[model samples]
Target: MTLKLLVFIHLLLLIFMAVGCNAQHSPEDFDQVNLINSAGPYLGLVVPNSFELAPLLDPSTFIPSKNVSHIDLSGRRFHVGIIADQKVIVVMTGLAMTYGQGEDDELAWESNGDYTRDIGYIHFANYSTEESCDNLLNNVWFNPDEIFPKNGIPEVREHAFWVNVSETYYNLAEQLQNVTLESCINSTTCLPTTPKIVKVERGCSASILAANAAYKNLLHEKFNCTLIDMESAAVALVSLSMGKPFIIIRALSGLAFSNLASKNAVIALTKFFELLSDKPTNGIEMYDK
Candidate 1:
């Protein structure tokens, strides 16, 4: 879809924090030169892998017709379909980074984690300490520098970059913060409390998939980021560079190496789509949390 149309529909991009582990490669690895330019108008849904994709594919949510188009570009597959009466193009993101890697069956997703919220702003930083940031800039695998120049985005720097989520979309999310979400994975497994949306002051995005408590603490205490992610910053940068408004809704599956995180990313997304179907007025007032 064209960038303007993407913003028009309030393309609420749902990206889970857990997906950070799978994105270890660059998009150029797939040779997707015209991937975005040639696409049609549709809401774009980006998920990290199958675990997140499974919920959306349920017949209750996604409806596909015989006229569905399956376009294979490089190693990634794009599925065009309908969801909540909105035409959508759903694609599993991080494919290029994981193309050659074999299946990771051991990987699991949980919906009960801390800081499950709709993101308002993103702060990008190096995965390593400042002492190593320079080294990382020179040796990183998925450097944004190469892509930014072509898109007219500012060149990547060894320091951090900050960007804001679309105010329109953020306000919509703010309205949904109090909406209750499913807390049970099944009758036997359940969360102590249901998931709810909250506005984060900032979210830290780096290429590294962090599972260390010390690092997670640094992001919180030092950067003032309530959540950590790997993809949203890059997505935010590209969207801003094109002057397209976007919002990233994130659900925490777990906390840095802690197995206690819940699995509500899908549940959160389902609630979001249900709201989109209603086409709510953007006039809803929101408060900072």
Candidate 2:
């Protein structure tokens, strides 16, 4: 073969090798890098993707994903501001439906949902509060909410669900003393306001019903938490394992077990981000009693 022909053959071989390497990269191969971590204090903002989370981000910079949901591609994931400086990474901990459809495990998941999909998010699930919250609904065949007698008082009132929002953040309230959210673009009536600081021992994020009387009371008595959501616990879990400073703040737009207006959800998330940019209140500590 001529010299030119041989050079072309070598170029093709190089291209093939590059393509092969790229294609071989599975989700597990990239897990460590993509999972959130910081050498100093970092914030992991977990929310369900809804009108609730949208207005909190900068205008249009954090729009919904146009890409399909892929386990490794992170089509549903995105960032705001500078990661190094702001230390903020917004996480959309998908709802009950999203978990069943996307993940591949059944351990923590309770549902008409099955765990047969990509468990690329396992690191997050595995990391929520130490001890893995294994006893969250301990000794119950059905979910605690399912099996707990409709009228029966909880048997496990002192159960500690767990939290990983680091001790550093517990006293970081001084940093947020002067901040406020002045407005919300996506909301007409959600209205901008200040965020509150609370030392919520255990935060649970799930369906609206989970925030109701029997279930809500159980969390309050067992874990000493009064707020509810499906996102916080899981986020706290991941933060603990990663050794990042984390906290979950929520607002009560509507009473739990009552009609939760969309605006209420939006308002709660609004305060969450505002709190993210600042620290909790100083002097007045969130009490355990």
**Highest lDDT among the candidates is held by which one?**
1
Per-residue accuracy of model 2 over 1-289 as CA lDDT, tens digit each:
0000000000001111123434655556354233322121223355554444554454433332222111233334534232213334454545553222224333223442423344444333454456656533334232322222223466533222454344444445344444343333345634345433334445554443252355457667765665666556454433333233455445444322112233333343344445545553222222222
lDDT of each: 0.50, 0.37
| TM-scores of the candidates in the order shown | 0.60, 0.44
lDDT of 2 at 32: 27
- Candidate 1 C-alpha lDDT tens digits along 220-289: 8866877766667666665555445556666664323122222344445556666766765233222222
Candidate 1 structure lDDT: 0.50
lDDT of 2 at 253: 43
The regions of model 2 sitting more than 4 angstroms off are 1-43, 60-75, 83-87, 97-161, 174-202, 205-209, 255-289
Off by over 4 Å in 1: 1-39, 95-160, 255-263, 277-289
lDDT measured at residue 122 in model 2 versus the true structure, 0 to 100 = 35
> Of the candidates shown, which would achieve the greatest TM-score relative to the real structure?
1
lDDT of 2 at 147: 25
CA shift of 50, model 1, Å: 1.4
